[model samples]
Target: MKKLFLGFCLLVGFTTIAQTVADPPFMQDTADKYFFEEAAENVDLLQIASDRNKAIKVLSSHGLLLPHEKIIRQDVQYRPLLDMKLVALTEYQGQFVYLTNKAVLSNAWAGKLYINHNIKTPKAMGIGPDFLTMIAGENDFAIFKNNQEVWRSSINNLNPISVQHDLNSGQFLILTATGLYQVDSDLKTVKKVFEATNLTAFGFYGDTIVLGTTNGIQILDRNTFTITKMDQKLPWTEITSVKNIRGSLWFGSTKGAFKLRDDGKYDYYASKRWLVDDQVVDLAEGPDGSVLVLTQKGMSKIDFSPMTLAQKADYFQEIQRLRHIRYGFTSDLAMKTPGDISTGYFHDTDNDGLWTSMYLAGELFRYAVTKSEDAKENAYEAFEAMERLTALPGLKGFPARSFERDGYEVGLHANGFSEEWREKYEKENGRIWQLSNDELWRWKSTTSSDESCGHFFVYALFAELAPDKAWRDRAIHQIKIEMDHIMDNDWHLVDWNGKPTAWGKWNPDYVNGFPINVGDRRLNSTLILSFLQTAYHFTKDKKYKKAAENLIKKHGYDENANRPASVIGFVEGEDLSNTWNHSDDEMYFLTIPSFVNYSFSEEQKEAHFNAVKSHWEVERSEKNPLWNYLFALSGGKNIDSEESAWWLREFPMDLIDWKIDNEHRKDLTKIAPNFRNQTYTEVLPGDERTLHLHNGAYRNNGGSDGNREYAPYIYLLPYWAGRYVDAISAPQPE
Candidate 1:
């Protein structure tokens, strides 16, 4: 069952990231990979000079540091001066380790095994010539040639022995496309275990191998070759790579990452970013056995030290006390800090910590649900956190923007690090968009430029609970800024930034990153329409009604690229990323039909709907991995029974949660004619296919180019699909 859910993995391969590819139109991939590059530079520096912890500190060369979590930080210090930039870095004990495929071998290591001499598939002198097979062990090693094998050197004189594969865990987990055979240490003959039918990753916990596919996490008992499964309903799940730091059993999927716990259920922390490109590269115990991070993001220590278990436990206890956790919104995460960049963030762009702190607290809040005593305590903890968080700090000009209670950054629109970026943008060529360049930047400021859509959710919770006029006014004002994008005299939704050159107008780099850019009208328009619709529902804000009507009236169905549905969004660039384009159309599907049906705009609605009905083929086209009913929901609601049912039943139904669509980009249909095969998209490799590879994260623009932004519809849809979920019960405006 789990294996069946992994059917979509290979079908989502995206653009070239590390290798050579065609040139981009203009805006270069300015994303700073310095941390990765730096780590790679120190490859082969993994000499065991003494304590494993100290070696790790030395190897890090300051590229990473340790934090305290469940795993305690090792007390160690070392010199620094890393040469090669890192692609992958991990600290085990005191020794710092790095990976560089192009490395010259101060000593060589491939996969995880260190080689005395470079491994060689020595050429055969005769037909089917016998080759040397070297096996690794704790101290000793063995070599096998032909059918004959011998053990030599070090501890136990032990060699890797073949063991039966656990079907639950699946056989043959593919790492680097190389098949890894599982075996037990206490064995003699090399026997063939269950050859994996087709899978990517597996988690080995003592005798149990956990397979993580879209369906759920399946536990395979190696001895019995039996499969037991545990599935949590969600969009995705993942199993982490091995971490030898604390002899731990760690894994992560749609549910989250976990460390081996005595209680059997692993201690967990879940986040889309914590996993790899939708794959868990490593479930590593860092310098400190604190929070185990299941990702490839290069950093020695993930600083979760401040979050103590007692504090978290108390937090959990409080969360369990409440039924629903309502939160207020602020613009703290959206800021660019003050004084540096050229682009202006509409909100709290600097203190990213403000949002994440709440997000983390939210995690604890969620965990409290299972324990009732914890529930009582968790509610109080969350409330305290929320009130304490109300006063956002770090605003530059507005004193009112400063949350007085906590002294954190606060504001509604056009503020934060982006403002700082706007101040220094031309000079720097681009902006970090977040705050403070410190390596452990979890509590800092940031965004993907396309971040405005979710801005109100945070604040709306606040409005729902407290109903402050100030919060209401601020939310309303920020939304109006989106309407300002339309032409005053004509009212057509022109390119918001008004870039003239084909590329400049759309600014792929500016609009398609991650959180999303406000400069995007199709997106902002959809959200704006929805916001107004929502506001009118709550406040009867006629202003929103007026704006939605005028905006829809001025743009009409045929104004964009000739097709009404295609007109859902406009790009000033020569081309659009898969993520951006697909999500753009979602806005139309989500709002236009409902808006028309409800507001007595039948004639125009039918016309626009007809445009959409005509272009429906293009919107659902499979040539790009970016279109679907999901986008429709992002803009409005995914109330379709078929789509909803499919989502619920097949929603990450297994431990190995991979959307394995075997068809190549050209072979798949179900999408649109212009789309089924997107040779038309001229985007960088990493830029176009990023969304498809996320571990249950937002598919912002689909790829780095922003094609899969429609991905969020998968989660956001049920909220507005008129379903009977508790948080919001409003139906589409009529």
Candidate 2:
């Protein structure tokens, strides 16, 4: 009877090991459509305008700076001048005109400088058809026609601020601090057209004239000559400049620039996301339907390039390949100068394993859909880097947070690490830096559940999908060791100290210790279940299946695993639990696939499907592609495809970490802060907000001063995943 029992145990609990990766049955509409992509480059700018050929030209302190190409860029081609201190510029009759302190000159039309040296203290200048010029000074203005002074007029001591050509009226308009004036094209009559206080700027919008004031904007009808005040909220009240580009009114204020959308809502372009500085000095129409904004320090071009989602994915993929690779791991760029890609360098991050796993998963998806050899090579390289993390520690199934060469560990005085902090860290986490087995490298410790979740999810996908048998076996071997270590060590990642790592604990005492309201309790339960399911799916081991069943039936883990995300917020008296943990969301969504994909029974799968849906419903407003695609894969219908595509299409082409602040914008409806940290009624579009991965997309305001360039994996992962699952389609020809 004892031999029979032992044989039963061996048959059911023991197993042979072997090995192994989107949401959705919906196909993305493959119609060729275009979306505007935004990026920024720094150039010294005093004024900007497109030349006759539609080439971008900037007036700087030195002279004119022309775009190296038709598009704006950092290394603008310089046109040096030693003749005058240029303060203003205009484009007219295929001639580039410039304004000095007391003279107006053009770029040697017919080999002769069209100079008006009589104009004194030039404050502003404007040019019309045939080089008809009006130069406004402190108290007077002069008009020149065909390089000849035609008329001079006194401004009534109001201090002229701007001179502009009214194309619709064929007249020149002069703006002073107090009012607007008009001059006939024949240079015969001058009339005071309007009177307003604190007039700052103006732009012609169709048949109406839009005027900018210190408080708000005023519009005047050209036919009726009646003025109406605009009451809509602006990004900032004090408009510095305004221009009409492509029939839309774009206003520049002290805070930033915003465009009036067709829906009446303003698309705010502020912070370093769209400009070098928020203090805008001028606005002009740029080449190829772009808008050039001149600020206190530099010029920024807001471009509108026609691109498809697939094209954008290729764009981000190129960025990922060109700059983000580090030791086979996808890495972000650290820059010495803000927004300068040339000054960028790659560095180690706390979530190297997690980030690389995400990128590797993306490449695998790309290969699955397109069968690109490049994508396969990318996946293979990332897999090796991750495998090295597990091998470096020499601890079965444990992965390092990151690694560096032997001499790269920061000293006590370096990188803000103090002796006191190091001592405390040693006590709690047992020395973050551990010499690898080879002694040629150092691996970071305190390997949290974040890394493990990424590891199991990606390794399993590799085992299942890798084309080569040896690579698939290697991936399966890694998964078996990791799952075995967790199960053998009481469902915890026992670090080198023989104690469970701080965030890797899944024991009932550790997970259920918290009240049902805490997210850790729910998340820990979900994580362990998914891990076991994945282990069993690949290894076909009864022990993994048994361990999972025991947790669910005996420990109430099933109840905890299905808890809605709404219930997992703000546990009072728990410091770390006082707010929603974004990192936890990343770990949860990343690992939830296994729970849904490898359910033990139909009933369990149904419950998991509902759990994924419930969570996705709560996050619906975020329009995050990663979460959306994950839910679609979990058997969810009615997933938001348009909004998900919008999220992907609007992601900024510039991956630089530029400081973006939205708390001060008046266009947003402020809401009382909640446990989820949602501080506004609506989430900002991707280009309008800070660059965030799936985790921080829900955050209202965040960014650093152009220091780090995030790896493009944040966009690549969802894009390629969507492509693989047929939720998104390949690029169609234009």
Candidate 3:
């Protein structure tokens, strides 16, 4: 019996070892990189206090967690001395380094520092910037800022405050422009560590420090204040930088990057074969320990990972970085797949709203940076997919909004049209609605037609920003076709091809159709004014002027008698029976001033601008996050100071448990799990709650309205809020 028990235990041990050695999907040598994002959050912080050690062992093998006192909803909430200006200010060990000027800090001794406004009470010890700006130790932070000897610390913030914290409790070799110094609790005060004439930069692994100076490389020991030289030919140029990786010293020069192993040998690791000027701007370690090299030309990758990690980055880089790779998209600049379109690659996330937003913003980011390879590559791929969309014909002169996964036209309002699909579409469910001839040019019931489409404006914005003039021409040509060809003397824009059926209409506050008796004011606004204003933003065309001017003059901006000094309603006309209002009233309020500012006619400009501001003052609640985002985008005078953080407050405190909400309907409260693939009623709303985080859009297990990534608002809100203005241009997507 004892032997039998021993045999069982032996089998268990073997199984555990086997799991540890389980082969990854790809080989190690060819691996490029792997993402370790949110790795810490995936750890079970909800584990029992008794099992804290087990929790630590299981959590955070990669990426980083920004050192929090407690965990909320499995996400770390680090209480810092400064208020968290951004959601992601971090602490490595115990020594906290503020990413934003005002960041949250916490200590076992002091509680928390709250941020009332932009002003901070205790001026950050290192208010400006840090050279070796990484959080290295548990309670220790290393900043090579002023003098080589002036590193700062927060040893007082720790719980036990031991001299032996794995990361924080370590020696700091400060590198100032003047000289170097070392501060230690072991010593009475900060003492002179070493002296170097023109020390450039340095990185610390532990007590050992590698310093870059005008004289070359000097290695210093913390306990003894002794300096030694290991490599006589250290790569130290005017542009050289230092880092310690994999327990060995490394350096980056204007020409290339090199590494030193424990076996007393240095090798040239990173260099550009396709070089222009060969000047390295920055070098940092990526998620999977790949050598990240930033050069004057663009970012480059090094393929050397551990055999267990990836000896060659070819496979790993391809597998891990989904951001750079396209799926089901054959057309690529590098190489074309058999079924790829003529333009280029297809999609990283297909054509979902989330993917569209990311692609749009990312494209803007690329253009803002001006010709970075990452930006170019991403834009190239997006343009290709969008271009293919143009190939799909329009219904009643407007392109269909979306397609089925099979690449067939499934537009509810796109049966007969000025443009037709490449492949013929047959009515499968008999749910297809065909438009009537009377609706043509009248802008009524757009079961499918593109007279005054708001979404067309979004499409227009992207089309205008496209690098290809041909693509831009096509987008503009479409607008011309609608404005010149379809817009008849009656002044209505829609030519409804779909048959009038008893389908429910949508409003900002109501999801499904309320009652047939209630009227719709939004559809007209979305179709008419949205398109004109968007065209103005894009082409600055005088042709769009005719349609927008007519609407403003006739409707009183809402359907009242005369053009009033004050705008009555944004969405002017609709059947009161449908009970629909244009939720996008904000679009008019935002774009009016912009249009006015751009206009040569001063009277028209002020009239529009003044009307927008006056209406906004009355309409905007100033409290809702969505309106706050729009208010900021409007670039108005007498703005609210706290409006910026108001947007941040809604940034989904727990990204994991992100609740999908429609807010428009109570019936479709939450989507159900196991829902995917089936689009346009093919998949039930109950099916949308699958744990899918494709790109950043996610809907998991019985959700409604496909919140966030699954929703359309997340990307638009941030873009409108001017979040990327610091990184790119403001007021509009490029």
Rank by lDDT, highest first.
Answer: 2, 3, 1
For residue 646, what is the lDDT in candidate 1? 28
Q: Whole-model lDDT for model 2 versus the true structure?
A: 0.75
lDDT of 1 at 186: 26
Candidate lDDT values, in order: 0.31, 0.75, 0.35
- Please give the ranking of all candidate structures by TM-score, highest first, separated by commas: 2, 3, 1
TM-score of each: 0.33, 0.87, 0.37
How well is each residue in 1-734 modelled by candidate 1, as lDDT tens digits? 00100101111211111111111121111111112333344332211112333223222323333322322122233222144432234332233333332221122123333323221211101011122233333333344334244433332322222112333333222221122343322243333333333233454577766554444455666565466555433223433333323456655443344445465533333322222223333444433334334333332223333332123223332322221122322221111332112222322332222332233223322332223443234323433433332122122101111122222324322332355545564244322222322322112112222222233332332333222456445544433442332223123222212222111122223333422222243344444444455445345557657766655565431223124334333334433433335444433343442232223243543444454444445533231221232223122122233333223222220111122211222111223433223432322122222323112222323212111111122222232221211122122222
Assess candidate 1 and give its lDDT.
0.31
Residue 49 in candidate 2, Cα distance off native in Å: 2.5
Stretches > 4 Å off in candidate 1:
1-598, 601-734
lDDT by residue for model 3 over 165-262, one digit each (tens)? 11343543445544555555334254445665666656665786666654556776645547855444543344356765546566765555556645
Off by over 4 Å in 3: 1-47, 50-362, 369-373, 376-380, 383-390, 394-396, 405-456, 463-471, 482-527, 533-543, 552-582, 585-600, 614-633, 638-642, 653-734
Task: Flag clash pairs in model 2.
Answer: 20-462, 20-463, 20-464, 21-461, 23-633, 24-632, 24-633
